[model samples]
Target: MPHRSELYEDIPSVCWPIVYSPDYNITFMGLEKLHPFDAGKWGKVINFLKEEKLIGDDLIVQAREATDEDLLVVHTRRYLNKLKAGKLAVDRGWAINVGGGFHHCSSDKGGGFCAYADITLAIKFLFERVPGVSKATIIDLDAHQGNGHERDFMDDQKVYIMDVYNRYIYPGDGFAKRAIKRKVELEWGTEDTEYLQKVHTHVEGALNELKPDIIVYNAGTDILDGDPLGGLAISPQGIVKRDEVVFKAARSRRIPILMVTSGGYQKRTARIIADSILNLHNLGLIDKELVASEAENSKVEKMIRDSVTDLTNLSL
Candidate 1:
């Protein structure tokens, strides 16, 4: 018997780094563009795949700014009110600098690395408009803590979040809650193998326990070897390996994943990271083309299986 074609259907990924523009300046001085590194790499990945005829739609845009009611799905009314007025709580450090990540922002104020809400709004938009995708499983793998997401989904059972961040790091609140289904807090020198192991466990649990309809992968690359913010020492290959691991896990479950390049300060690091994730999307296209090639079907299957075996055996 032949193996079943378990890949997700032909779907165009919805991304906002290119279309959505924010007015705030990033913490770094030279990074003075809306959506910064993400949009550029997003274009590169999409363009490369399109030129190769791997993906059809050439649209490289983010959605228009979300409305206040859309944001209310995950944020508190009081917090939103204060953010619009630039008011801050005494304890909360500052408002979210760019878009949503309001987990750290308290009900009465703002804090952590978020400004105007975006993630929650995006989730709401997709849930409402995108047919067959009812709930989302957010996989936030940023080096820094995803404090905002952990906070926002604290009580909501609909959204399942599996955040992997540094323990006792800045905005040290992503793990001290009950909302997250899995929280892997790495120390300063977490090795790649250990990190991948935890990711495998978390993704497996999410699939078995939560059984999400759609997956939104926060493909943050700050965990690279020399990232100023990340303490973990992951090489470029290490980062790529982690991405392949995540994708393979999702593929095995036959899940449709919408990848959001979450965070990565370094440009080169960001490029490589985006390429690895987007490569999977491209690979999906190649596999789709192979569906009609009965004569060459066995060869493609061998290639995919061998590749999978190699990736699964590697450390980190």
Candidate 2:
């Protein structure tokens, strides 16, 4: 089996599979205005969830930063980085990593502001360490093509990729396009109606075509109507509905799924993410058995929380 990893910890049933860490947020000065991605949004999403009383800090799993050994599962030695939450997905029926989705990164190279291949790592970890998880399907809904995972799994038949992206946008890599089993290229300003319809059709078709052991849903909100980089135009409501479509499909098939919030440039993107998770709970797609006991007060957990709070003040 793969070398023992702390990533595959025995999670308490009282906690939801949703994974996050305070270090997930990247805040440095006031640069959130200049970049195409809101670096501080991850923490904001957690705060929104807290505001809604959907979950408490101890009720969600605390994600550990992937060590170099953990990253080597799917990354090149020269390009190693961090990721996890796959094993958690298998333990629970589903999981959502509030701070990943680097679709522009591959094992050998990183591009479009994405520095590591998190999605690729998540799948490979499962195939190597978890039984009955040999096959995986990647449903990438970012406005930009998920060239990173595509390149990493190019010749691997055990992996299936369904990408929906704007044809005119960045990283228009034709070579990477070949790896996508189901590709939906969109026009400029493609609104909710056309975007959602095509996504729904391709998602269902892809799932129908192959029943994989697990699903990796790369939910990138950069497709929101006015994103400077993403040329497509999809409304926030459309984005929520799109996530619902994917979750419903995975639930219906009883397949374990891991979701990564990949990209979204707008300031409101964090709220949208928390809203989608809440919507999923509202629809009965994801739920937790709230234990009557109060939250665990482990010393290690307190240390991690304090460390992350300090790191969030620094640049990522």
Candidate 3:
């Protein structure tokens, strides 16, 4: 049997695949404010969703902190220990981790305020533990390149990476650029039309190239206009539309996708994320009834399998 993990526990039928936890927010005596990134934005995103009646605490999947064993699935032991000396992981079926799009951190190092490679770990875990999940596609729309996972999965053919980022941003790792199969490098101050067009084109192109067992969408809100670091001019509506496009593509293909909210430094970024999620729900991309029906089907399948197993055992 595959190693059991709290992160992969079967969620209740009523719960949505959106994963989050209060601990995802970082607040060290207000020291987090020193950084340009809004450290508390994770909590704010959840709050806004709650206020909008899109999701409730009870209906959301609680994210468990990735343990050393879990992190080691994709990270080096030395790197895992480095995180242990410092600090410390997703679901299947169109799940979303409201926190943890740590795209700048890799197996051997950490950067860009990211301490662990959660995106890498999530994909590795799914491939290892989930049956028939042999391939993954990473759709990274973060304003900065997702150099971290790019480096980790450099030679791994099973993982296909598609990154869209401002070319001039921090950690401009030329070596990491080699890892991106579909690289869409945007110039500084790129606007909504051009950015969205590129995203739609490449996303469809990547899926058409190879339909993976799952998709790891690093849905960073930092692309919004006036983001201090993202260096792009995408509007809030653009962000919503972008998400809709990705979700529609994944749902239409019946591909299980997992999303992680990445780097968004602005105060309003949280609101934009919330609104985008609401738009997804409203559009039936993440329908509650659909999930409930899937859960019922799963239960029925399990019961039939159990009955067959019992009959076989009795005959033996």
Clashing pairs in 1: 19-62, 96-114, 96-115, 97-114, 100-118, 103-148, 104-148
- Report the lDDT tens digits of candidate 2 across residue range 1-316: 6676555555677777677777766667877567777888988988999999999998877765555666566666765434322222212446777877888888888788777677887777666655566788999998899999999999999999999999998899999999999999999999999988998899899999999877889999989989888887898899999999999998777666678888789898999999999999999888763111111433432332222111110012
Kindly provide the TM-score of model 3 when superposed on the true structure, using C-alpha atoms.
0.89
271 Cα displacement, candidate 2 (Å): 1.1
Error of 2 at 44 (Å): 1.0
> What's the TM-score of each model vs. the native?
0.64, 0.87, 0.89
Consecutive 10-residue window with the lowest summed lDDT within model 3: 307-316
lDDT at residue 225 of model 2 (Cα atoms): 87
Q: How many backbone clashes does candidate 3 have?
A: 1
lDDT of 3 by residue, 1-316 (tens): 5555444445565776676777777778889889898878878989998898878989886655555665666668877665552212234355666777888888888889887777776666656655566788999999999999999999999999999999999879999989999999899999989988998999999999999867889899999999999899999999999999999888887676677788888999999988988998989888656654554667642332122111100000
lDDT of 3 at 202: 94
Residue 53 lDDT, candidate 1, scale 0-100: 55
Model 2 CA RMSD to the hidden true structure, in angstroms: 7.2
Stretches off by above 4 angstroms in model 3 are 4-6, 85-90, 292-316
How accurate locally is residue 226 in candidate 2, as Cα lDDT from 0 to 100? 91
Best-performing candidate as measured by TM-score: 3
